[model samples]
Target: MPSSLTPPPVQASFGDTDVYLFREGTHAQLYRRLGAQLSPGGEGASFGVWAPNATEVAVIGDWNHWSDLADPMRARADGSGIWQAHCPSARHGQAYKYRIRTRNGDVLEKADPFAFLAEEPPATASRIWTLEYDWQDAHWMGTRGAANALDAPMSTYEVHAGSWRRKDGQFMNYRELAHALADYVAGLGFTHVELMPVTEHPFYGSWGYQTTGYFAPTARYGTPQDFMYFVDHLHQRGIGVLLDWVPSHFPTDAHGLAHFDGTQLYEHADPRQGFHPEWNSAIFNYGRHEVRSFLISSALFWLDHYHLDGLRVDAVASMLYLDYARKHGEWIPNVHGGRENLEAIDFLQELNRACYRDHPDTFTVAEESTAWPKVSRPIEMGGLGFGLKWNMGWMHDTLAYMREETVHRRWHHDRITFSMVYAFHENFVLPLSHDEVVYGKGSLINKMPGDSWQQFANLRLMLAYMWAHPGKKLLFMGGEFAQRREWTHEGELEWWMTDQPEHRGMQLLVGELNKQLRGEAALHQLDFDEAGFEWVDANDRDNSVLAFLRKSRDGQAVLVVCNLTPVPRQNHCLGVPLSGTWREILNSDAKPFGGSGWGNLGEVRTAPLAANGHRHALYLTLPPLSTLYLKRDADV
Candidate 1:
């Protein structure tokens, strides 16, 4: 249930059920009864926090004049390690922190780990807020259960809200983004918009990855209600919303989770297992029952309170590996002397199971970059139970191949075809995410090896190939319009790039790619099955050309040919199953896409000549540095 409709009782007290569930790691609605809830009497608020190590705890805020001696909390009689206090003066909208006296005699002030709101960054006080909103997205929520299925057409527009677009050099608020961002993404023809983390964090540079408030939507945009409006508006516009969820590690800020109550309650006490050296953060103690409940409650809060369509979990690879980013002596092995983090694996399994059990319409995706098997498989089959997994191997290999000079591309042709080796192993999302466009890596367009004209041409070919490939699609903001500069969290995307014809043409190509991807059943219906794709001529390395066929479940098919070289092939012959004319559906070399205007014009006829083991062949003109999509005549 949403917390907005489930406030605590007037004289709330912890019960045995709460204690049992918390200890058993089954407390999905802990956010509702815990945290600061308004008193049923409407006098003030009831504050509760789990701080077993604290010898004493108090609520300090503006209401108490930040006094450590005022509003002391009492330990629960159920022996649940929870402290609660009913303050008649600490009402809604007041900022507060828990002042705890540790066993070592040190006093510490910490923000509420389950706070529903927090003061914006540079200030670390948790605010008392009642979660309430008039949602208007029932139509979308009712029909979203099947929208993320394996066979559905899902082309996602990966966005960083604070930087997607700005007005007068300032971040756009959620209300403004609700309308503007929704309209823009809809026009681009993407079915979903995946926002970079919006959870409350202290630093803008972390891009919301280093979260401080798990339950609070970042005030960097607007209030929690405003964020509800953002999701609602996007849903109303027919765009599903996905949040970037970071459960791997959290920042070690002083007022944050680290060293709370002068003890490592949230993280493991061992540095080898608890501390993340690369991010300078703390890894959650997934083996702990209360900790698992806390994290699980956070995951459910977004879906229940804000009506989000899905969660794209970040750094899943880090969570799964015990030796991630560590030297030989710097890490500790699991109980079985293995490198896998067994506790995290169990937690993820439970998380996925809970998501499907509680909110069947919502999906979970893993940003896992490893060979961990069956990531998108079901939990019942010993798999991670994610709806989709990012195909990082494909992204890395394809980009590396594209960066090579065209004259040398033939030698590295395997990079283009190798992904198919494991294409069906897991349901994949071919992601060109924000990570690819930042941190000293050049923009997608800049990665192409060529002059201005050829750069745009290569980008067009890459996108067309992505759309026609065997997977769902995802592209980060600004990539569609060919932004010349690498992405930075500090500023918005270069919207002015669309003024140039080359940039405009690149954007147009992306839009058309999305349109075709959604309209053609052969492109998406059988994405995960071997029956959908058949290679026509994958061994044409010398000429830098490859051809394949994509088939829908209904027997509809589309033929795709790629010319990777700068020089055009006048009569490229490839086998076809149908004996009829194949009409050109999309060509990267079309003039409208800023190509060299060299193509088959519109259609090509098949010959009875045998080629590539097929009885029928098509001798067609293949354009340079382009990808062509051709649909066979239905009359055949």
Candidate 2:
């Protein structure tokens, strides 16, 4: 959170900016939120939202239809709080807001339910114009769909828009955000930016999980047009954008879509079936045709609208379980009650299928943590159908290992090495997500078990291992800089640490890691679908050393040796599959990443034995808690 001393980075960054850092791309907004052009497509469109409470509600502002309606909303005896009215003579290049009469018999300002653009005010809401930009994003997506290089090292930069920067307790706009954020992210060398949910929401907190509008980009940040320009700008810089999407549940807002149309239009009708016990949110009835359509349409809307490269579905475990949030009195037993949200499963499959079918290049990733089979498998072969599933087990297992790891006990081979068993079974991404480091768990940096020096060493090694692992890699924001505090969206990254060299050093390492991800064959295409990665020493836990070889189907391999021990070891014996020379590629013990001045650059060792019908064996000195990648050829 922003410190009292600093008033939080949010105040500094969001300071009256006209844009946000992570805006949607141009041409990416219209397809998601379709609107009928008012007045022969002259420009402005009048929209009416249903908010039944108290009395008067008016569409005020640049529309000028009711800018003077001090108590804009009108009251009805129904007491349902349904406020509706047409914005007369509404047009573009203007602002608006809801002049609503609250239940307390008092008037207050609220943002428009359908407004695409919002200003930080008393700021008038801008009249939104439908995006009709001409371009070739669809064409760009088409090529990546067929055979885009999935083999390139994939290092993703995770971002959160609201907390990324909010000055004066206000949000930034899409236009301002796009240019600044694109330059910042692209300059960092990240191949992709994984943004937290941008879906429209009423509250500023909840990190967007309590979503009210399935398709609307939060007007809290900016306008649809501004967001679109952000996306287009990023694409021009060669950055892939992945949106954080929430289809699992909806917020229980009274005026929102939850009970719109005077029915359970978006969620289940029964309280037992509709609500989440812990979250106090509404669950969808995926079994319903319209519900399924809503979700499927949502997936398409993002892909088709902003031309986002992909989406990462949130809280999939809740969606996967029948009694996810069940309490003693509020739960349902699905035959076995061992988590059988069948409709959710079907809905997932359909969503993935539609995305792939409509745009093969576009990806749909699930945040499911269970042992759900074939999460990344093609839908044809009895799978939930996702381009990728978060390797949640790997995250937990690794974090667990680190918490207990030290210089003395060496390491437990089984505990540290079990993730590979399933990490790559289906296309998966290893993520140190916001879930693992937020709300008191602390940041990934603080998870390490030691003082400043040791902590930095451990973090670098962890990231090295994650990058070299079989699956793709992602790190939540603030983690790159080794922020020693837990995450709170109310503030910007622990920017106070910016003055510390260690913090800035970690940031540099992140930038370099993102660059390294661009062409590392062993990372991108290595065993993406069961064709790469093997453990040469899976059970070598005694020395706290784990070694493995990751390869592509073409027979190219890179050996990774990681030592979790605190003290360096000499000639750590390990198995080798080749008899040729293996040279050192990347070493975490190097000075650039704030290592303990260990590891030799370009050190090469020839294998002494043969295995797997090849003499690919090698031996070399190993550093404590350091990761080194060995390349088999100049090409690797």
**Clashes per candidate, residues 3 or more apart or on different chains:** 0, 52
Report the lDDT tens digits of candidate 2 across residue range 246-284: 888887665455654445656888887788777888888
What residue runs in model 1 are displaced by over 4 Å at the alpha carbon?
Answer: 1-10, 40-42
lDDT of each: 0.90, 0.67
Error of 1 at 61 (Å): 1.8
lDDT computed for candidate 2: 0.67
> Cα deviation of 618 in candidate 1 (Å)?
1.6
